[model samples]
Target: MQTILSRVLKNSTFITSIISILLGILVGAIMMIMAGYDPILAYNALFASALLQPYDLGETIRTITPLILIGLAVALAFRTGLFNIGVEGQVIVGQLVAVIIGLKLGLPPVLHAVVAIIGGGLAGALWAAVPGLLKAIRGVHEVIVSIMMNFIALNLSNVLIRRWLAQGTDSTPEIPESASIQMDFLSQLFGGARVHVGIFIALVAAFIMYYLLWKTKLGYELRAVGYNPLASEYAGMSVKRNILLSMMISGSFAGIAGAAELLGTSGYQSIQATFTGIGFDGIAVALLGANTPIGVILASILFGVLTYGGGNMQFEAGVPFEVIRVVFAAIILFVAANISGPLVNLFSKRRRDKHRARHLD
Candidate 1:
């Protein structure tokens, strides 16, 4: 068991994530003590609410579903050497398109849902394609273009929601039942929490991403370009084309996240005064997950637990929920500092030296 644990801890990414989380917890405890709160009681309430209660657990899962998708979006962009700060815009466009299609299309239940979801993803892909094209063709920095596009998408979504698609208010009408992703059995099983079949969708998406990134030729080209675009271009790869493709794929994940949130949970699309922080939060998710599909899923679940439980902590311990955000920020800071890299190297070197001594003996 010890050997197994040692092998697992030898993985740099895993070790880094664990260390970051531990440091985050320690810092959070210190902050709570400074704020005149009992850290142990606060954390107990948080865990009890988020994990031990059925309704809260379901809500945590609901939060995890979209986070998994958005995390994948950010991870994909990072792997392709692009900063996709426009996931918020992609999500907005996706939700708008899904709402429109769900309202207008009359079809069989399964077909309607599928079409609406796909349509939303396509809209997100198109929305992101603009920035991708500018970056690829005009040599404009993608980060700048994506940020500008975010504002455009937000304003456009607001206009469409209020004027064009609004039933009477700043939101579209509840989508047709056929287009919903709600699962009655799961809801009942979870004590009427809003958990839905979207969790399954998120899982499938993660599997697909894993397969695409590790098993496909196209993925190789994309990663190769990311590592060195000039070298890839010299090797006869289309660097520009790969950039566009990567952005579209990344945006599609964000679009699916929007679809899941609207069709699976909210049942209606509402205009937002500001961007939902999910897209931005996805950056942290991808960072902590080390840009891997499995890592993203695990990290998303952790985030979901923290987010859902933070409310309970606040209510029970009189601690501010913003402290959860502070914890998260601390974790990100530690990860960025590469605190675990040296530790990992030191352990590996010690292990190798021990093996060499054993062989000589």
Candidate 2:
């Protein structure tokens, strides 16, 4: 408990998030006023729409699906000091691969779903591996390479969806029933809701990631390398391999995110070239979660609420949906700029000095 409190106290990022959240609310209210809207009514309506209404609740969960998975991907790479910006590309590849497998070979329900999800993960791994390999062998910076790979994947997905896989319609073929994770079967249970089993799958993955990062030897090595690569190398750890492994795992996680969206939620075989912003949102989720699995889960839900609420704000208050983007941008900037090690050291030292004075009693 003491350690937890001390860590929280020392974390400038956490403090910054809190401050930014409050500031964002104030700024949003000002915008609401400028637009001749009542801020209080707008906020109340936003909460009601996002949480109280069934349709809004469903949309909230839908948005969260990719956020959780992609946030996990980013958090995983961060554990090994890798900034994997290729999650956007990895997600696209995963979506493509899952749809391909679902359409190509029709199998039993369980097997088909498994293959589609796994195939998506593999595609993500392959996409991420290119940058990983470059970083490992050629000493290239991963940030630049990963960003480039995102563009490549985006264009590739566009071409594949528009030309080859498209069914002469806006989207590709409908996924085989066997591979779909829609909750259509549970119509009697929830009044024909769109909520699928994919949410459970995402939660399970989060638990698995928590265990992998906290209770395993590989996790330790990954963290060691992340702390200091040169020191990790001197300690006889395979720094290069760990870097590659980190990126692959990160990419795989993001790939599964895409699969979750394609099979479990959207069910569309072909998505737009610029469909969702989950990749970018994942970065914010990672920071808010404090780079922990449990934190990520909580952060994802909070973001879901915001998104849902924002939609309500738009519908009832006449506020623009784009306002949410501005709020998020402000919060991210504050969190990114304020968090650092020196802040932790300063707080720790002050606490120790206090402890020494108390001991004299």
Best by TM-score: 1
lDDT of 1 at 194: 97
Error of 1 at 71 (Å): 0.5
Which run of 10 residues does model 2 get worst, by summed lDDT? 184-193
lDDT of 1 at 138: 95
CA lDDT of every candidate: 0.90, 0.82
List runs of model 2 lying over 4 Å from the truth: 1-8, 11-16, 185-191, 271-275, 339-361
lDDT of 1 by residue, 1-361 (tens): 5456556666658888889999998999999999899999999998889989888999999999989999999999999899999998998888888888899888789888889889888988998899899999998998999999899999998898899888788788999999988988999999999999889999999998889988999999989989999999999999999999999999999998888788889988887888888889999999999999999999999999999999889899888999999999999999888788777567778778888999999
lDDT for model 1 comes to: 0.90
Lowest lDDT sum, 10 consecutive residues, model 1, at 1-10
Per-residue lDDT of model 2, residues 1-361, tens digit only:
6568677856535565666577777777887788788988887887787777666677677778788899999998887899998898899999999988988887999889989999999999989999999999999999999999988888888788888888777678878889887766543344445667777777887887888878899988888988999999999999999999889999998999998789986676654657467787898888877788877887788788788788778778888877777777766666666644455678678788889999997
Residue 309, candidate 2: Cα error in Å is 2.6
